[model samples]
Target chain A: MTMSHAIEVHGVSKRYGDGPLVLDGIDFYARSGEFVSFVGPSGCGKSTLFNIVTGLLAPSSGRVLVNGVETTGSPSRSIGYVLQKDLLMPWRTIMRNVILGLEVHRVGRAEARRRASALFDAYHLTGHEDAYPGQLSGGMRQRAALMRTMVTDPDIILMDEAYKALDYPLKIQLESELMDTVKAAGKTVVFVTHDIEEAVTLSDRVYVLKAHPGQLVQEIEIDLGTDSHAINERRLASAFNDYYETIWRSIGAGGRTEVAA
Target chain B: MTAFQIEDAQTGAVRTRPARSRNRHPASRRRTLLVFLQVAIVVAFLAVWQWGATGGWISTFLFSSPEQIISVLAQNITTGELWTDMGVTAQEVLIGFAVGAVGGSALGLLLWYSRFVADLSAPFITAIGSIPVLAVAPMMIIWFGTGLVSKVVIVGFSCVIVSLTNAYRGAQRVDPDLLDLMRSFGSSKTQAFTKAIVPGAMSWVVAGLKLNVGFAIIGAVVGEFISSSAGVGHMIVTGSSSFAMNQVLAGVVVVMAMVLAFGLLIDLLERALFRWER
Candidate 1:
């Protein structure tokens, strides 16, 4: 419980009843303020691992420690999760959707409104306060979801392919915004992605997972140290290809039986 | 859809061709024609009905003439009886609908929240729902007396199952992803219920409400038929007793208009509240 890591998983294993392990002996950690990524081919249990970390699903075996406290099988407000879909309540305005977490915690209505409202300008969502989620574009919807997740100021944020749905340009834009914001706020983030280039571009460290008894096979440190604030600029860096190549090769070398999503 | 338009076969291609007379502006002429047809049919039916009733082909006692019914309606309006009967029926319907909504939704939520209770009560609800509502009307009158109380009870009885079924389905059908997101925020069961489950099921609840509107009117009217001093149903019963065909038809027309009004009101309210949907 007193570990120095911001989050840790030890010997985590998962399986649906009587089924073969989807995740086996999965061990990883993110230090405080670290940006970590999990990369694998389709069906590599990357999402399963993220779901377990978010406490949305049980691990079947092993434990998850968030900020040195075991949070296995119990959801905690300290960690925020953003699923692939925006999951915005269609009935609520964008502002209200962003305030849902705070509202659930019984923060007074005005206070929650103020906190949520503050993000509108910062997140490029100004003047969209009264708009419903359905009215927004896909990229904007995801941004609102990010605003919702980050508004609560959770210590750890788990993203399960949060940007894959957007077009390339918006995906890069959002990816950049997300990293810069999380880095500036000093929050630990664990992102799961199918695209190795994205994994390398966004994270300080990328964990390569193998399918068919999904397990961590390699952990690569991305030391591009690029000065560009934009993800497109990061991708253009001379070192970007080397990092992408490395992660792709690592994933390609893993188990070929199971696919990733 | 714009990628492929229907072919103008004689012209061999649609995109290069100017619009045809029939297909011009897509729905332009079709729209006007449809509306015209609808109005023409209504007028034609009324003309035939009026002709038949006035011409003595159909007995006046059996099927009242349109003119006679209109005069009867005019008489009721001038005498204040139309408003009184309408007001009485509207009050019963509104009150019954309110009570039924509350009770039905509460029980439905209970069923959704508790597996044990839902399993136990499923068969009972089905059994009660199958019972013809009119059969219970007399018993309800005997128990609660010929007043608003009995009508409300019958309305609630008629409506609870419809609400319960829709609401319970709504709760059960919530997106698991939404539930997960709520839980990740440390929301308790009650919080999830209020914040996620209920909103997820609001559409279903609205559907049940629409169904309840018809049931509520039926229960109220039937209760009145069993015994009541003033209501649309009471007027119809009295008109029938005295063999006043015009009055009876007028009472039926009023009831029909009332039900249509209620339906339209609900539709408007739903549209306003869920404008975000469209």
Candidate 2:
């Protein structure tokens, strides 16, 4: 039998204490090694869905399956999450911050450092091991934050608009690095971003959601002609604009429908 | 030449002045000048004070000239009497500060952990924290006796409140996002407290220590005033009773120096602790 998808979200819905539905009947899945992104306007509960998937917040209804095993309301050790803010502890050095996950997992200090040090060269933070987070630039700090997640070696990664805080150039640079490393490692990624261009360039598939209940409106498979590892080169593809326009129109239509009602 | 010039030299690169300036920065020069002026003003004031007292223009018995104060200080120093007073006072301040600061910080950590304990103690902390050190010093002397123990108790009482308040505030201000991050990693509550709360609260705790320097000294001196034999406060009381204005002024000078020295110590400690911040 074939291996199951990396993760499956069944009819997940959430509401806060008799309040309006925050998320409605969301079904999502990512096959092994697939890159999936959720894009929407603000207040679409993109973050809420992300939290439900991570098991940080349990859905009011429905369950999650990881590798065909039913797991809901309990975070799997196989998943790693990177938030929008780098959240690197300002008092700790870059290396120490990266090893926080390993320390939490109770990995031996020497082995943890050895494993974490190997990724520093790829993350562009080799010389800054002892330097504190305040000394690093925003992009470098974000990279360190990613390293902190990636060093734990989880099979499934969740990034909530991780590059949204960066400027255009730095965002693209980090995105390219993220794609190269994550794809090379064959990890399943579930990303959330509001930037249509970012979603189209980096994701294998995109899920578009509408706000005020945050239901999935559309899912688009992106084909940029060639499966290139470098995300920067994919921007020039003709189909990139097509995918971008489709997602944009889907969200725009949803906005109009809400306004008219 | 223009006041500013950009000349193309090598590789068609425009060079504006040299890369580094050899002259002193304007701010540094201003700082040096200010220090010189300050010293000159103090010297001028002292010269006038000496002239006024010796020439019978002012009452030496009332005001006491700088020279007279200086001579008394010099005499105490040479006879090793000042050292004894300073040593006694320093012990009280240091011991009291260490006890109060450590205990207060631990109490703050406890409050951070248990909301119930924190809420219970909030009003009592405020009530006890505001009670004046002078108002309580006499009671402290009566309770602990007029020995070194009474002075130490007074000093500790004066300092513990600020330390506790600052530490609690610091712990409260630690970013909630960091705690969430820790939770996502499946870290235990103890891990979060030690890793996030303690280090995050350090700067505020250090600030509390700095503020407590004055509080500690004040407590020790006041306790001495109520009843004591060897402290600088005792020296001041004796000098006042005898109408020796020079000795009184000399004691004031000694207290000022002690405060300055302790302040410098805290500065060094702050630098050592927050090297990462720089």
Judge candidate 1 at residue B51 and give its lDDT: 94
Question: Which pairs of residues clash in candidate 1, taking residues 3 or more apart in a chain or in different chains?
Answer: A41-A260, A42-A259, A42-A260, A42-A261, A43-A259, A43-A260, A43-A261
Predicted structure 2, TM vs. truth: 0.90
Worst 10 residues of 2 chain A by lDDT: A252-261
DockQ of each: 0.70, 0.52
lDDT of each: 0.86, 0.89
User: Model 1, stretches more than 4 Å misplaced?
Assistant: A1-3, A257-261, B1-37
User: What does candidate 2's lDDT look like per residue over A174-203, in tens digits?
Assistant: 998989888899999999988888888999
Docking class of 2: medium
lDDT of 2 by residue, B1-278 (tens): 45445767676765557433534486887788999999999899989999999999989899899989999989999999999999999999998888887678667766899878888999999999989999989999999998888888999999998999899989999998788778778788899999999999999899898999999999998988889998899889899999999999899999999999999999998898899989
What interface RMSD do all candidates show, one decimal each?
0.9, 1.2
TM-score of each: 0.90, 0.90
Please give the lDDT score at residue B225 for candidate 1: 87
Highest-DockQ candidate: 1
User: What is residue A105's positional error in candidate 1, in angstroms?
Assistant: 2.2
Task: Report the lDDT of model 1 for residue A117.
Answer: 85
Fnat computed for model 2? 0.43
**Model 2 residue pairs with clashes:** none
Report the lDDT tens digits of candidate 1 across residue range A175-257: 88888889899999999888788887888999999888888989998888785658887888888889887777777788462
